[model samples]
Target: MSTDGKSPLPPMDWPDFQPGWVWLTGAGPGDPGLLTLHGLNALRQADVIVYDALVDERLLGWARTGALIEYAGKRGGKPSPKQRDISLRLVELARSGKRVLRLKGGDPFVFGRGGEEALSLVEAGVPFRIIPGVTAGVGGLAYAGIPVTHRDVNQSVTFLTGHDQNGLAPDRIDWDAIGRGSPVIVMYMAMKHLDQIAAKLIASGRNAAEPVAIVCNASLPDQQVLETTLSRAAADVAASGLTPPALVVVGGVVPLRQALDWRDGLADASVLDAIGRRTRDAG
Candidate 1:
């Protein structure tokens, strides 16, 4: 394994993380191994690391000694720092001549509200850099042995959040259009509203028996995957006793988990060969 647990790659001169600049970075799901080199570079250089709840604590180990680590994670129904306050804190820290690193789980741009924070920094005249990380929608699903797309399943996929700014199912989302157009739908933080979302899709013409997979604590050692039908998803998830910080995937691609699950020792050699053949054929 590479020193960081990620795949080995050619070395290059990394960018200088200037003090008094804010770096918004994605920590990549829950696995330290999945973190981008650029994100890792920030960790080693930042004076203060402001991290979210979903970010694995293990990644913080890479930070420089004496680097101040601050918690600013926001969870459903949890009393946490307000978004605006968090943005202001970045501005405050940057102005203090500190190298501020805003480390979040998954891609900072994907449903992470990084853009909002960046805008605040811009208005405050704070220089910043964006380091994209592997989103849970893809990386997390991969860890659960579920592909977002497959030649035999879907050619397109949709990524969406389960709730809006108000912490409820988004009212702006066109369930009808998405249900009818997208063959595969990957949802972040949808476990809380799974029943309603599932109903909306079913009412919008999605099959009631469509395969759905919910992955919790994705990319972590204790990751849990629960598979059920669109109609029974809510019930099954409740029965499984899993909580939030989970991803919900809706599509025909979910059943492929039976063949693609490779984590630990769960991989089946025959299925692996079949997947290889299919991939080669597609290529």
Candidate 2:
């Protein structure tokens, strides 16, 4: 409220969502609240919202009534719109004088095809802005009550994708190096190849019994976690029947979830089928 009886909704520094342009925004993980202020603002004014599979549908409620909501999510092993086609659609929408907001899950640059889309926009000369959202590794671990880095455990953590563009576990990365040095490893889009990845880690220098936590639909009501060891992770995940859009965390930090789990194992049913030892103290 103001003296003029007007609401100070958006600050003066807020950038207007101009037509004939596009905004590449990260929608964060599965929680609607993880959406950035800029992302919400773009949603309110966007004539077309191109959202992804991991993006919570609840966030779309912020969009102005009658706005066009389009799905362009790329889930592994599922039929998805071609990446090239999706990028061209944004250009087409902007050229047609529509305010386009290309919404993605997690930080657009981190494993999201945002760079490819941004390049497409640049080649086509479409003006655009980038609004970074909370990446899954950060927010997901927070929800699971696992610290990304623990002083007692190790100061270094590694973040990587399980599969490459071709949907195969990345071979170029030196898993041996990561397993030998990295104290904590957070992986995204890894459910499909969890077994192969775990084998690589074991073959590299990581202990077979190293604690591993698989988080499914993190930061959302239906979040499920499987706390197991690196050796049993694949079998436990298979037996538990957890699905994709999940994260696999391997390190001593996995045990921290027992104390930090605020989900309380109640209505949200945050199931934790632990196949490893659990203790209240991190030490």
Candidate 3:
């Protein structure tokens, strides 16, 4: 077994990356190790790879020699291609007899827009395969010692995006219901409107003092976790200068970090505060 990042696999009965077909694969959060075997296989065989903004570029090194690389990533508040254009590009590449690979961060279908691209492939009659990867909501939280669901803390979890295409809080989501019903909530792309979203939840009856943890650059070497209350989440994030590409989780589970955090560094100051509060409460 190779101890290094390269994966020139010892041959197996792997499916062929046929010309005129696209494989939509997930690269996982930010850790290259989180990549699935099937995703790695697709990489070594694809003639061309179209990747997203969040995808770790290091994964590209595993691609076949001379394989073409194309960037199709979209970041909020930046000039980016239209989703339609990206989908069409996949079709164009596949139809041109290239072994196409559409790579994304996290699970392709889990809010990664893999479904929309798949539909485009379908409409174009291009064959494709899906290789699922660990989503940041689950895997990212795990690295930060926050469980999305636990028998002792929560039976239901809600995963949501903080903003819609217009870059504002989503109006269609019944925030009131989610605030009350979901014992654990994981939010993607939420840092931008953290304060507004927190207020909405509080207004919807969620406790202002509920524990909330923001995991930044999750699963990466520079990963940082900030633990605070719903009321303090926005303020703490601002004061700490935490940025996007982060996951926000709200629940009683957030306090469990005291016992669960196993990373090399000490837990954040806010996390220590949470532990003291919990200890006092238990006493």
The sequence of per-residue lDDT tens digits that candidate 1 reaches over residues 190-239 is: 98899999999999998887888999999999999998888999999999
Q: Write the per-residue lDDT of candidate 3 for residues 142-192, one digit (tens) a residue.
A: 888877886767778999999997889888999899987888889999999
True-structure lDDT of candidate 3: 0.88
lDDT leaderboard ranking = 1, 3, 2
Candidate 2: global Cα-lDDT? 0.86
TM-score of each: 0.92, 0.90, 0.91
After superposing candidate 1 on the true structure, give the runs of residues whose Cα lies further than 4 Å from its correct spot.
1-11, 269-283
Stretches of candidate 2 off by over 4 Å are: 1-12, 265-283
Question: TM-score for model 2?
Answer: 0.90
Question: Could you tell me how far off, in angstroms, the CA of residue 93 lies in candidate 3 after the best superposition?
Answer: 0.2
Give the clashing pairs for model 2: none
lDDT of 1: 0.90
